[model samples]
Target chain A: MVKNRQWRLISFPSGRPEASNWELVETEAPEVAPGHLLVKALYLDVAPYMRGRISPQPNYAAGVGLGEVMVGGAVGRVLESRSPGFAAGDLVVADFAFGWQEYAVLSPGDVRRIDPALAPLPYWLDLFGLNGLTAYFALFDAGAMKAGDTVLISAAAGSVGQIAGQLAKLAGCRAVAVTSSAEKAAWCREAGYDAVIDYRAAADLPAAVAEACPQGVDLFLDNTAGPIHDAAMQNLALDARVVVVGTASLADTFGAPDTGPRFLRQILVARATVCGFLFSDYAARHEAGRARLRRWYEAGRIHSKFDIAEGIASMPDAFLRLLTSRNLGKQLVRLEGD
Target chain B: MVKNRQWRLISFPSGRPEASNWELVETEAPEVAPGHLLVKALYLDVAPYMRGRISPQPNYAAGVGLGEVMVGGAVGRVLESRSPGFAAGDLVVADFAFGWQEYAVLSPGDVRRIDPALAPLPYWLDLFGLNGLTAYFALFDAGAMKAGDTVLISAAAGSVGQIAGQLAKLAGCRAVAVTSSAEKAAWCREAGYDAVIDYRAAADLPAAVAEACPQGVDLFLDNTAGPIHDAAMQNLALDARVVVVGTASLADTFGAPDTGPRFLRQILVARATVCGFLFSDYAARHEAGRARLRRWYEAGRIHSKFDIAEGIASMPDAFLRLLTSRNLGKQLVRLEGD
Candidate 1:
């Protein structure tokens, strides 16, 4: 029997997550049952969305209960299998259902087969997984992005942010990025953004966004819904479309109410539409989206940078880094290297 | 030359209008020019949207300047015509450009001819005019009201609200009304709402809304963007559509920012869409919309009630009644006998 080490939620976060809120536990990995397989976590993804899973609020999904294994996604390898669909040593990727652990017992339906030979294992989570699917549907479907749209993407150097900017560029839109640092802004510019606003360095975010989009933003792909959202609200072109994908800046207030200048007036003034969507809504067409994303990746039309931490012990820290917007790209913890 | 009495904006309001903000002026009416017609005002419209036009804010339309005629809509009879499209004795309806006056000078393009023989003159400003068309397009296009949708309409006894609630019922959706008082709620019930919530009397607004809409609101027609908006935000069903049609409650704060719970989190949690649109955006298709509304009105499928204040002197008071939710159905001012 293989030994499994996993992190379990001890308490819900009051504000930002604390290390004491999680407890590490060791147990024997469960033997495979009929129609099920066991996977050893290769690389665990730490995303901003995970913060919602720990909060007791009206989230899109059910929250992780106290003493429950902390939820996450990971690229894993099949260690043992009782299902005909999977064999030992086969590579797989699990989304959200994969807890923050060294080993997870899952059914064949719980995971998708992935080929490491096609690209690096971490790339499945970073570029070809949730981030890619999210950016594609949120930008084109929710945002109604079209040719010549002035697309403003917040969190432009992060996982989904990077992919959305490149996709906007591919669609012949003027891609303007709002990132936290000069280095990330430089990276965004090199990645084909028409203009980059380093939000942390700007004296006035709304002015910076206005300067970058002189004609006003036609499609604002909002991932950070705080000051950046307010700035975009103040600079919408006629009939603008805003897609709310993530609230990276509001992680601390997930379970409580936060105040901001109401956006309804701006929405009316510009005749704009604001929509909120989750990637799971497009799960049926994931394969199609992944195919186009893979083509873009192979042709170097899209690129991704991995910001990885060392081990299972770094899971909470990696997530904190993501919550604080410290990670440059996809934040991941390597339980074992690819 | 005709003697005319009109109300001019003397100052912008800080909160609600207090009757001291308008100036009554008596002057000789301008004669018909090369392309303009002179009309004697019969009925003037008082609406919630007019509140935005008086404020110095980023509204959908420009604010009425001090010393300018208080902007409004009216049904009138042409006294003299200098345009080929119209003749003396023609009945017409002018929108926005028709001031709160006894006479107006307008170009042929500024007004639409009305057949007084088809319906009562006041119906042109109520059931068969902006109110009906706004309800039609907003419910179908912006609210995306599908058959069987549980629709929640705020300010349900107001002009557009009454029409929208009925339109949702005609489309086979469950029409629910949120009104200010029990009397208005009773009117909404008589008008075919499946449920009615008297927001002013509700001990817990959210609880009242949830109890009324046990299945949650599928389409929320937001007319008053304050507490009613918050209650609806707390109870959105999956894939709900929220159409911001008017801001009756926010009128007092139109030129300044107001604090409210941020709605992005609620929006994302429900995977919902919120859109803001103006009836002017559908101006090109107004004729078709008016025809349908006329058919509905003639068929007894739709209804309208007029809460009219007498004479041009009552214009500001009639408008203030609308702003304070003191008037029900289509608020109007009769400058002359119908």
Candidate 2:
């Protein structure tokens, strides 16, 4: 019997998560059923969205129950298989339901096969996974980004933001990045963003955005939806499209309602559209999105960056750092060597 | 020389407009210049949109300058014409730039000719004009409303609300109306709304909306964007569309920023879209919208109700009443016999 190490939610987080909220323990792995496979976790992704799952209240997805494994996405290798579709040594990626565990018994259909040759194992958690798919659909499908359009992305150095900025540039649109620090801003520029707004340095974000995008933003990919969203709303061009992706800044205030500048007048005046996009809704077309991402990766037109924490024990800390914007790119915990 | 009476804004209103904010004066009418026609105003429209124009800050349209005629739409008869497009005794409609006045010399190109026989002369300012066009494009175009969709219209006894409720019903969608009083609620029922929520009676608006639309709202035509908008945001269905048409309740709070519950989380979770629609953006397709409206009117599938205040002198009072929700349906000042 294999010993499995798991991080479970001991308590729901009131604001920002703490170490006390989680309990790391070791237990024997469950027996693999006839149609299931035993998988050894390689790399686990800790994202801003995980903050919602640990909250006491329910979100779009189910909340993690007390004593349950802390939910997350993980790249794993099929150690043993009882299912006809999979065999030992095959690499696969499981979505959030897989949780933060060293070993898991998953059904064949629960995980998607990935080629290690595409990029890297951690990249499957970044570029070829939820992050990349989110950027792809939010920009092209929801925002309806077009050539000559000015695209503004908030949290510009995050996993999705980096890819979105590069994608916007590739689409022949003017890409602007809003980052919290000078370091992230420089990274965004390297990623092919035409302009960068250091939101931390600027006294007035709307004015800064207006200065960067003189014609005003035609498409906005909003990740931090507090002041950044309010600023973007102020400078929207006629018929602007705002894609609501994430709200990392408000992670601490999830239990209470957040109040900000009203957007109705600006929206009405500019004839703009603000849409909330959840990537999972486009599950049927994910392969299409992945194929395009692969081509872009092969062409070296896009790149992925990972801020990885070594070992399974660092999962909670990595997630906490991600929530506070301490990480530069996709936050991940490396569980096992390639 | 004819005496031209005018209602001019003497000061920008701080909150709800008062008679003291405007001045009624008599001036000698200018001679009809070549290429211009003398228009004797027959009916002047007083709408919620007019509140935006009288504000200190510029809205989608320019604010009415102090000492200038209060900007509004008006239907008039051409007394004399020197331009090829217009002739003496022809009826015409002029948009908001025309200003509130009994007589004015305007370029023939400044106004569009209208047929009184198509409907009543006042209907040109109601169902056949801006109000009708707003409801049409907002529901059908921006909202992309489908049959079996549930629509929630705020301020449902108002002009646009009444028409929108009926339009949603005609489209085979469930129409729920949120009004301020029992009387307006009864009127909305008569207009074919499936459900009515008197917002004044509900202690918890979101709960009331959830109770009214058990399945959640697919399309929201929001007129008052304070608490009602907050409630609607809380109960959005997946891929729901919110059309921000007006903010009548916030008419007094124009000087200061209005803060309410932030909608980004709700918007993101539901994968919904909120759009601010200005009818003028669809100017190229106004005729198509009008043709559809005319057909509906002819087929008795649509109807228009007006609360008429006699004479141009009552324009200020009519507009004030409309702003306070004191007037029902489309508020208008009948300057002359129809």
Candidate 3:
């Protein structure tokens, strides 16, 4: 029997996560039941929203239980299948709740076969997967983006950011990206965005976004919602649409994001719309979103970037880094080298 | 020459209007110009939104200037006309921009011919006018009300509130009206609402709203923007729509409405939408809105309650009452004896 090491919740985090909140343990290999596929975990995706999940909320999906494996999304290789489709080395995307483990057992319904031709393995976890689908639907469906509209994307160099920026350009929109670093700005600029604003360097972000876009922002895709949201709120044009996808700003415990005063008034005066969305709600449309996203990727119209941390054992640290915005793009941990 | 006693703005109030801010003066009517009509003001409309116009903003028209008759919408009789289509004794809606005055001089473009058959003189200032159109479009067009959906209207006894509540009910929605008093609650119940919540007495409004509407609120017509807005944010169902029309909360003067903790999370989790709109933007559609509202009134489906304050000299005190939420339904000033 193979021994599996898993990251379990030791305690709830109060603020920034530390190693103490998680405990690593060895467990017996998960049994492959009938109609179930055993996946040897190859990569674990780390995201900012995971922090909100660590603390239990009655409204949301079940959070990480004490001594239970930490919850996440993962890409793995199907080592054993008990169903009609027997596979030995098929790359698959698993929706198994907890991903920071060496192996997991997933029902066929919870897993999707990945086409290896779609860039690389990390690309599936980043661009053509949940992250990319989120940015696409949130901007297009919820935001109601039109071609030639000025788009402002927050957290624009992250995994979702790289693809969103390129997608906006592909759709003939003028994309203005906001990133935390100069390097990420350079990355966003190279991604074909019309303008890239280094949010950290720009003391007056509203002025910078206005100056960079020239025309006011028509659609704003917000991933990090602190000062960036406040700034974008002021600079948005009449009838603007804002999609709130993630709140990296709230990762710090005991303190909320520092959204400045006059935020709602900004929404009022501009006749703008602010909507929040979850990717799971769009699950039925996922395959369609992915199909369109795949076409774009195949046509070289979009790009995916990942900041892979090296080991399953370092999952806790990687997750902590993800919460702190330390990872440039989609934060992930590779169990083994590609 | 006709002797006209008018209420003039002696000074613009920095905060709230006081008796000293207005002055009553008698003047001799001037001769009508080449394209101007002289109107004998009949009914002057008093609305909460007019407070915003008086305060120095880029509104429908300029601010009510100091030492000038207060700007308002009024129903009047054209006493003398220099324009071809206008005739003496014709009932008309005029924005001479001086409704608080006994007489007004208006250009042809600023006046609309009124059909007295469909509505009485007061109807021109209430249901078939700006107040009614504001309620109709804000609920139907901006809020996008659907049949069988649940609607929660704040300030349900005020001018727009009374009209919007009836509109929502007519649209086949489960309309819940939030009012500040027992009298208003009884009025809302008689106004054909499914539920009425007395916000003044309720300790936990969100819980109260949820208890009243077990399935949850689908659309919120927000006029009071403080705790009611926060509660509406919490009680919103997935993809719920919130339409913000007025800020009647006492806290509106300070800054942006304060959304309590977990408000943004509630919005994100519910996948809800919050949008603000001004009725004046739909000026082109005003006639269409009026026609539909007129049909509702003639069919005996719509009801309007007026707190008529007699005389143009009472305009200052009348405005003070409107601002303090002391008036129910449409607050009107009778400029002439009926």
lDDT of 1 by residue, B35-114 (tens): 89998876665555666677876655578999998787777888899899899999998766787777889988778888
Q: List clashing residue pairs in candidate 1.
A: none
Q: Which ranges of candidate 3 are over 4 A from the true structure?
A: A95-98, A253-338, B57-62, B65-68, B95-98, B250-338
Compared with the true structure, the alpha-carbon lDDT of candidate 3 equals 0.62
Q: Report each candidate's C-alpha RMSD, comma-separated, in the order given.
A: 25.4, 25.3, 25.7
| Positional deviation of residue A36's Cα in model 1 after best superposition, in angstroms | 1.8
How many clashes would you count in candidate 3?
Answer: 1
RMSD of 2: 25.3
**Of 2 and 3, which scores higher on TM-score?**
2
lDDT of each residue in B1-338, candidate 3, tens digit only? 88776667777556555556666677887789998899876665455555554565333236777777766667788999999989999888853354566678888878778878755565555555554555666666567789988999987776667777777776789999888778768877877788999988999987988887787777777776667766775566655676666655532242223344223322332344534332233445534544443353345443323345654334335434533334432344443231
The lDDT values for all models are: 0.68, 0.68, 0.62
- The lowest-lDDT stretch of 10 consecutive residues in candidate 3 chain A is A254-263
**What shift in Å separates residue A302 of candidate 3 from its native position after superposition?**
55
Candidate 3 CAPRI category: incorrect
The residue pairs in collision within model 3 are A159-A329
Misplaced by over 4 Å in model 2 are: A261-338, B261-338
Most accurate candidate by lDDT: 1
Q: List the residue pairs that clash in candidate 2.
A: none
List, residue by residue over B136-208, the lDDT tens digit for candidate 2: 6667766788999999998776666776786787689999999877776877787678999998989999899
